[model samples]
Each structure stands twice: as structure tokens, then as C-alpha cells.
Target: MRINVNQTQCGFVMKNGCYEKMIFAGTYHYPACMGYKVIIEEMRGRVGFKEVPLKVLKEDAAFMSRVTMVEVPEGQLGILYINHAASAVVTDREAAYWNVWEPCELRFIDMREPVMDRNVEKNLLRLIAQQYYKKIEILPGEMGLLYQDNILTDELGPGTYYYWLYARDVLCRIVDLKMKELEISGQEILTADRVGIRLNLTATYRIADPKRLVETIKGVENQLYTRIQLIVREYVGRYRLDEILEQKEAISGFLAQRMREEQEQYCVEVQTIGIKDIILPGEIRDIMNTVLIAEKRAQANVITRREEVASTRSLLNTAKLMDENKTLYKLKELECLERICTQVGNISVAGSGTLIQQLRELMGT
Candidate 1:
């Protein structure tokens, strides 16, 4: 029988299904009486010496020199590097690769400990199967709570973390520690005056005690929202619509103080409470506009009447002064004549009577 192998492949010759020699690219002829056969395999990737055991192949210096052997014992992991770049994660007990194909190196990671080695490149974990390991990343302004098998294991700060998944069921809960806004949008409630008003409430808060918040509070946001709603209702129910509108700042202050008092219970710090908007019903708004217009008109009328009364008093005083002083009266007549002259284009002061009599006629005209 004549067998051929390509340059990128190698062949194994078996004599009567017994031990055989590894052959490279070439042609060879053997007698059929010898029961010779060849098995060809591509040697560009991982080496697969299926026809012969590794112990037997290791004895062949040529075969051993052409390949690299990676032994990954139990409770250990192997990271295979091809040409100085991470290529694959090896979890099996042993693996072999062709050294002639590419430069290969193996790095062993001890799995006896669940925590990943700090020296190991975290990016290399991408090559690992998700079922074999767990990864957690807590960002800035966030905290991570690590749990194993439904039990609290550790509280983790903001950073990347890894664990062996086979040891336990890993779970991480991230809680944001930054300031957050809780907006209760458009809550309709009745005031003491039985006036229905919609209020948009906003509260700024932050997680003060993350551990307590995680252990004690199931739903912190929902509970805090309910508390704020009740507080608003309680305070608003005691005030009339006019009072609420007038004392908006005072109401906000009271609510903030009340929330602060209960901060420990919710494991949150209440920063500020604000009445974002006080929306009145359409009918009430219209009625308020009407009242505002009427009030403004009344005030304007009062101001007008006050100015009129002042003018009349001043006129009476001026009349009394003019009656007592003839000169003052004459001066007043001249002032009136000057005003009348400004209005007329020409004044015909007929050589008639005195100038005062002429001015008096002009004033009458």
C-alpha cells in the first residue's frame, strides 16, 4: 500500500493495529501482507495523537520536540498562550498543542482557592467559560453585596471581582450610593377647605447605610415614597388652599424635617424636600383669577380716590391762602394765564380792561 501526507498534516502508521511511527509529509510503500495502514491528521492546531498514547509518543524525541504538553491537574486551570497572546482556557486534565504550528505557552491557575489571583489579567477571563467562573463589577458611587448560596458572604466596594462558580452560587447586588431624586408626580389631595389640589413633590436623598438598607428594607424607594405621600397628606389636610399656597416654603421645610427624622428607619439621608408644583383645579384657578382681578380693581379705585381727596384738600388750602393774600391771588392768575397761552396759537389782549380781566375772559373761553 502506498500512502501520502501533505506538509501541513502528519500520518501515523499502524502495523496490524499495533504501535506505529509518526510520519510527516511524504509517500511510502509497504507490502499488503504486513497489514500496514496510515491515519492522517491536520497538525495546524491542537495536536491529537489518537492512534498512540502520550506516554508512548513522548518517547519519540521528534514528536515530542514538535509539540508542547500541558498538564492541568484537578482543582487547577490552564491558560494557553499562542505567540505570547492569550488564546484559550484549558479546564481539562491535560492538553497538547503543536509547537511547530505556533509558539505556545501554558500558565496554570490554582483553583483550590475561589478568589482569583490579582496578578492574573482580568481580561483573560473572557476566554473562560461562564459556567466555570463568576464575575462582578461595582462601579464608582456604587456598592456590591456578595452572596453565596443565598447567604451573605461579603460586602464589596467599587471594583471588579471574580469567583469560582463551582464552589457556590454567586450573586451580587449593586446599590447606588449617589444622591438620587425621588419624585412623586402629581398627587391629588384635599385640603382643609375641601379644595382638591395636585401637588408634585420632589425629595433628594442618598443611601446612608447600605448594609441596613439591604438587610432590612425590601423596597426602599417604594416605602420612602409612601411615607412622603402620607406626610404630605397629613400636613396638607390641616391647611386651606390659600394657606398652602401662602406657606409653600414652610410646608417644604416641615416635610424635609419630617423625612430627616425617619431617615434612620429607611437607611437614607434626606437632603431636601421641595414642592415642585402646586396645580389647582381648573374651576378653582378660574375663580382665583376672578377674585384677583376684583381685588386689584378695588385697590386701584381706592388709590384713585385717595389721590382725588389729596388734590381737593390741597386746592382748599390754596384757596384759603389766596383769599388771605392778594399778591398770591395775582400770582395764581398769572400762572393760569401762562397755561392758557400755551394752549392757544395767539392771544388777542384787546386794549380792553386790565390784563387780569383779559386773562379771566381767556380762562372762561
Candidate 2:
């Protein structure tokens, strides 16, 4: 007598009368039937059966009887009978079989963990069906569906899945979503310490060109960030330290625009590129400040010189006007005399008569 154990076909197998008796007595000691007996007689009363003969029963009878039996062992068993009908059974007395029999279908994309709901398994199955059979069926989950192509099915088949498994999502990023970092140094550019400019630049980018981005960068997300940083460094290199510091807005705008153009091939969107800090060498910054101060001082001197020249010209014009008019001189003498009299309380005008006579002569009296 021969007994075969197969999980796919059935749970357990029973060979002959002797083997059956041995199994029933727990001599076989299989994990599925450890405490139970394999004999028909032992399981008969418990499983609600009268008698099971090897000849009268089909090959599946033993499996069906074992499934109905209350006590068995810990594993899946395939029960074979000579004349009983064929059947399969799980002797494990738990609900673990629920998932085993009804498995969930899932696809992982871009390292993102898929969220599952009550209908995840069902939806996943429906997705699989739609991809292969072109059947439109709604599944659970808030994720939007873009389009289905044979590409996905050709890759992953139907199977049970756990976390962190690799699979593709619906909308493939032209580039990967990642942060890129880069470091650069140049002789012409100012450096914080001495060797190079210490700039902390952060750029956020997503894959815009899936095919090209992947081909060029290997990892589109990280690669794009690095590329943008490189571009920024290059742009900075084109200008002097002062230019970069003074024209930050120009630098930022140029960086954003150039990055967009350069990465267009990858279809990547440069969400943001920030220059966290620009580190200038201490010596260089000090020199720049000194130069600025000197320039301002020079401008002040020019303004002062201009004001002096204007004042001198006004004084010359007043002197020239006084020289051109003798009558004006006579009036000035009288005015001086009156002012002196007011201060001294009395001034006998020996000059006043001569001044009045001169003034009358000048007036053609």
C-alpha cells in the first residue's frame, strides 16, 4: 500500500488497512493527525459516519472525512481512500487559512507602500482582470487610475503580497522623486574658509522623463537634484562674489529657468531651488566693505567741492555788482552812517553833507 501527501490535490493520504490502523492509533504521528487516529473506525463516530471500507470508498473519501473530523493535527493533509470520493482538508484548527485561500493582489510602485482597505484584495483582483480581460470593475482605495496597458501584466502576475515588495504604480515619474546634493569649488568664486564657496543648496524634483531620466541619471529623483545643484554652481562660477551676493534675485531666477530648460528632456519639474546660505571668505567680505566705504567718501568729497564752487561764484558776482555802480556805493555810505548813528546815539555828519552833495550830483540835480 502506498500513501501520497499533496497539499495542492488533497490534505492527507491513507494507504492500506494496516497503514490506516496505524494512523488511527497515532503511530504515524504526522503533525496533522498527531493526537488523532487515521483508522476509519476511530474517525467514524466522531465524523458522523458509520463505516468506511477501503473498496467501497473513493480516493477523496478520506480527505472529506478528515475535513469534517473535529480533531486532526497541525498541517494541511491529503486523505486518500480506495473507494471514497476525493477531497482536501486543513487540519490546523485556526483561521489562518482565510488569507491562504483568499489572497490579496497588490503592486508596489516607486518604493511607495500601497495602502489597503477592506476591498483591497478584491480591487486588486479586479485590476488584474481588467488588465488581462479588459473588464471594467471598480475596486476600493482613493488612488486614481490612469490607464492600463499590457506592460504591467507582462511584468507581475497574480500573487499574495506583503509590505516593501517591488511593483510599478500607475503614473510613472519621468524622474524619481528625491533630493539631490552637490559640492563645488572654484578659484574665482569667494569661499567661506579658503578653498571654495560654501553654499547649501536644496532642490526638490520629480521624474519628468521616465525613460531618459532613468537612462541618464539611473535614479531620476536624486540625479535631478544633483544636476540642478551643479547648474547653480556653474552659474555662480560665471560671476564674481560681489555679483552673486548683490544679485541674488537674478541668480535665483536664472537658476530656476535654466534648470527647467536643461531638465526638460527628463520631463522633471524643479519645484524649488533654494540657496540656503552663501558663505563668503572673511577677508573678501572685509575688503568689499572697505571699498564701498571709500567709494562713498569719494562721492561726498565731490559734492562738497561742488557746493564750494557755487558759493565762490556767488561772492564774485556780488563784488562785481558793487564795483559797477557808484550810486550804489553812495547809498551804502549813507546806510552805514545811519547805522553808526543809531549805535552811537549821535553822529555829526561831516561826511553826510558831502555824501548828499555827491548823491545829488550823481542823480543830475
Candidate 3:
């Protein structure tokens, strides 16, 4: 039998179903009667010789020289490299590759840590299978809490994180750090005067201590919201409808003070809290509107009376001044005559007395 092996391939000679020798890139001749057979394989990739055992292949110095073996310890992954570039991930206990392609190497990565090295190359990570690790991404304005086996492991800031999923369960919870707005809308409460009102409240807050919040409190937002609702009700119930309407700021200040006192318990910083809207009952609103219109009418009447009194007083003072001065009174008559002439356009003074005396008599002043 004649076998031809190209430069990119190797051959294994088997004699009567048993391994004999390894041959590379050449033509060889053997007698058919000798039961010599050859198996050819491309030597540019992984090494797996099924016809011959690895022990048998390792016995040959030339075969060992042309192959690279990588041993991946338990609970660790092997990153296979060809020519200093990561090509594949080895999850098995051991792997082998042919040296004929390029320089073959392996980088072992320990999987025991919950946090992966930040310096790990993204190209190398792409070679790993998804099932072997869990990925968590925390965006800006968010924080990540990492847990392993239902136990808190570490707090992480905004970034991408990876954990080995083998032999352990992992979970990551994200909490937003930005200011949050909570609205308690359409809340019905009765005032001191038995006036039923619907109130809408807005509260702004931010997480001051996320670690304490998760460790000490469950449903922090709900707890905070309930407290706010109670405080607002308490303050509003103490005042009558009119008093409450006039003292919205007082209610806000009361609620704010109460929230500030309890900030440590909730692990949050209350930015602001206030009543957004105050809706009165239909009957109450109509009554208030009627009262407002009646009060405005009364004010208008008072202003008119005040102006009339001032005009009467001014007329009395002017009459006294004119009665005491004859020349001043005569000047006033002349002014009145000038005004009458401008308005009449054409006038005839047929009276025998002076024009001022006639004008005064005609005007009935």
C-alpha cells in the first residue's frame, strides 16, 4: 500500500488493527501482505487520535514535540490560544492541540471568585459558553447587589459583572439611586369640621444607604408611603376646611419634619413632600364660591360709599373757600363759562348782566 500525506496533514500507520508509528507529510510504501494501513488527519487544529491511545502517542518523542496538552483543573476554565490569540474555551478536564498550526497555549482562569477580573479580555470572554457564567449589567444611576447561594456577597456599582454559574446559584438585584417621585392621589379624609376632602400628595426621595435599606427593611417604598399618608391625614384632620385651605404650607412643614425624624429608619433622604392638589366636595366648593362673590360685592359697596363721602367733604371745603374769597369765586365762574362755550359750539348771551353772572345763573350753580 502507498500513502501520500501533504504538508498540512499527518498519517498514523496501523498494523493489523494495532498502532505502529506516526508519519508526517510524505509518501511511504509498505507491502500489502504486512497488514499495514494508514489514517490521515489535518494537523492544523485539535488533536484526537482515536485509533491510538494517548499513552501510546506520548511514548513517541516526535509526536509529543508536535502536540500541546492542556490540563484544566476542576472548577476552572482553560482559555485556548493559537499564536497568542484566544481561539476557544476548554471546559473539559484536559484538551490537546497540534503544534503544526501555531504556538498553542492555555490560560487558566479560576471560577471560585464571585467577581470576574475586570482586565479579562472581551474577546476571550466571547469564547466561553453562556451556560457557564451569569452576566449582570448595572446602568448609570443604578447599583447592583450580588448574591451567591441566596446570601449577600458584595455591592457593586454601575458596570458589567460576570460570575461562574457552575456549582453555585447567583442573583443580582438593582436599585435606582436617582431621586424618585411617589404620588398618593385621590386620598379621602375628613377635616375637623367634618368636611370630606380628596388630597393628592407628591413626595421626592432618594436612597441614602442602600446596604442598610436591603438589610433592615423590606418594601421600603411602601413603608415610606404609608408613613407619609398617615402624617398627612393626621395634620389635615386637626384643621377645619377653611383653616386647612389657608395652611397648606403648615401641613407640608409638619409632614416634612416627621419624615426627617424617621429618615434613619427608612434609609432614605426625603427631598421634599407637599400636597399637590386639594379637591373639595361639590357642595362645599359651591358654598365657598358663593361666599367669595358676596364678599366681593360687599367690598365694592364699601369702596363706592368711601368715594362718595370723600367727594362730599371736598365739595364742602371748596364752598367754604369760595364763600370766604369773592375774587376766587369770580375766577371760578369765568372758568365754568369757558367750559360751557366750548361744549355749546354756538351761544348767545342775551342777558343784560355780565357774561359770568349770566352763565352762573343759567348753570344754576
Candidate 4:
């Protein structure tokens, strides 16, 4: 049998349907004698190869080359072929005939879903634009991490980047750089005065360095959340219930300051930290209400006593003015007589047979 491999093609040597070795472009002859039955055929054609690229093996950060042929030794080299890690292997005749080429253990990642563009691009625009070749869009509020052969090569910012598609196993990971808000609700905390309170806090943060944020901090959101919660608990524990009640803003400020200082090490920028609510226990709330009512009643009593004192002083002054002034006293008596006459009805006066004369006698006139 005679076999040939061209410059644009690669061949695989198989014995009774089992892979033996890979062959580059060349001519070979195998005698159709003995048990040396060898079969060589092209692995793939140009069309399918282009669609599923046979990229170059990654070596270093600056080295990337797309070769027409590559050798797969006996379990020495591996590759990310067609979105999955695979290794070429030669199986026995029976296994190969039964199609028993399987992939090894694979580490899968949760890749980002592609966001399709909504606008319709004209044919000419699409052809002339990078869409025809390769287009990777790092959307607004997102950061991209570029990886070559599962090793981080660079971090890309929000924008469009084009790379050689068939040159290497290239992947772009999108990390959201927008402000993240975390709310820890109903956290029971103890105060310095031995009061137990339920606290709720809202913390907003954004990624400062995407690379460091991923490399240094595992579970970035959860880390920030736990840090904030601890700071709140510690700071609140140092203050009494009354102090905390009166200084909620100060507590938030303290928490923000502490988080700002520590979060830098984790590549996070804490934006706004706020205490959403400071919930007192049911019994504490009742007691506080009772205290408040007692304070208000005391204040009201003081005000009432002050008014009474003022009224008594005013009455004493009026009485003294009437006693010192005779004409004023007689006018006051006449005013009293006028009031009495208006109030009383059907009155009879004896002696002088006049109500005014009887009233004057009654008053010792």
C-alpha cells in the first residue's frame, strides 16, 4: 500500500482501525505482506479544519504560531480541541473498531454567554468590519480576562478587541465592574450595655483591580460581605445602646472607614456604607416607649405648675390694686352688682322696695 500527505494536509497511521502515530506531509509505502497491515488517511479536510481550528500549542506569552501539522505522542501532549480538552490515544484493534477514543478528566468553567447585537449590520459593513474576521466585545461595566491555554495572559478593559482566532486557544472572561450592593439583614448584635439588637446594613462596592480581585479574593462578594459584617459587629459592640441609637451615622462612618482601609488589599473599593435599620428587641422597644411617656408627663407637669404660679401672681396683683385704690374698689363692686343683676331673675327687694337699695344695705353701704 502507498500513502501520501500534502503540505495542506496531515495523515494518521492506523493499524486495524487503531491509531498508531501521526504523519506529516510525505509519501510512504507499506508492503501488503505479513501482519504489518497499516492504513494512513487524512485526519480532516480544509473546510472542517477551518471551522474547528487546529491552533498552535501554547508555549510562552509572546509565542504563538499556527502550524499545519503537529505530533501527538503517546500521552505526552494535550490540547483544548473544539471547546474541550482532549488527548490523542491509540487503542487496540477491537477498541478502535468499536470507537473507544475518550477524553480524560476535564475541568469545566462557567463561560459567559454571548450577548448578540441587536442592530442589523449591512452586508458591506459586516464584511468590512471585524465581524467578518474576529470580534470580541467587552461591554460597559465589564472587564475581560484573556487566557491563553488556561493561563492568564492579560486583563482587558471595556471595549472591542480582535485576536487571531486560529493561532491559539484564546478565551476572554467577562467580570462585572459595576457597583455591587450587599445587604445583610436582621443580624443580631450585642451592645456594650448588654443590649441585643438586630441590625441591617447596605454596602456598595466595585472592583478596583479585576486581576487582583480574582486572584487574591476568592468569592469577592462573599468576602466583602463577611468583612463588613464583622466590622459592624465589632464597632457596635464597643458602644452602648443609647450611644448607638444616637450615633447611627457615626457607626456607618466607622464601618466605611475600616472597610476602605482593608478592602484595598483585596482589590475592592467600598463606595457607600450605610446602616439601613437598627431594630430594638420587642421588650426593649416597650421599655423605651414607657420611658419616653414618663419623660413627657414630667415635662407637662412642670409646665402646668409654672402656669399656675403665674396665674396666682396675677390674681394677687389685681387684689392688691383694688385694695389700694378706693375708686377702683367701688368700680369693682359696681361691676360685681351688674354681673349679679344680669345673672339673677325674678328678685324682690324689701325696706326701700328697690333691688339696688337692698343690695347696698346687704353690702353694708
Q: Which candidate wins on TM-score?
A: 1
Q: Estimate each model's TM-score.
A: 0.83, 0.38, 0.80, 0.56
The lDDT of model 2 is 0.45
lDDT of 2 by residue, 1-365 (tens): 22343332222233442234222222233444443323333222123232454333334444444433223333222232212322223233421111122232212222233332233334333223222122222223211122223122211212322221224334312122344443332223443322356676666565444444433555555556557656765677777665667787777777777887776765677666666677766876788789999999999999999999999999888777778987777786777656765788543436668897875664456
Model 3 C-alpha lDDT per residue in residues 1-365, reported as the tens digit of each score = 88889998888888998888889888999666999888898886688678866878888887888999778998899988888888888887866689977888888888877667777777776888888888899999999888889898888898878888878899887888999999888889899999999999999999999877877899988998899888888878889998988999888888888899998889999989899899999999999999999999999999999999999999999999999999889888888877877897776667566876866675666
CA lDDT of every candidate: 0.87, 0.45, 0.86, 0.63
Instruction: Mark the regions of model 3 whose C-alpha exceeds 4 Å error after superposition.
Output: 1-4, 12-23, 26-40, 48-62, 113-119, 130-146, 153-167, 170-173, 261-263, 350-365
Of candidates 3 and 2, the better by TM-score: 3
lDDT of 4: 0.63
Q: Which parts of model 2 are misplaced by more than 4 Å?
A: 1-195, 200-221, 238-261, 269-278, 327-365
Model 1 lDDT vs. the true structure? 0.87
Clashing pairs in 3: none
The 10-residue segment with the lowest total lDDT in model 2: 95-104
Q: Which stretches of candidate 1 lie over 4 Å from their true place?
A: 6-9, 15-19, 30-36, 42-44, 49-65, 83-85, 100-103, 348-365
In angstroms, give how far residue 260 of model 4 lies from its true place. Answer: 1.9
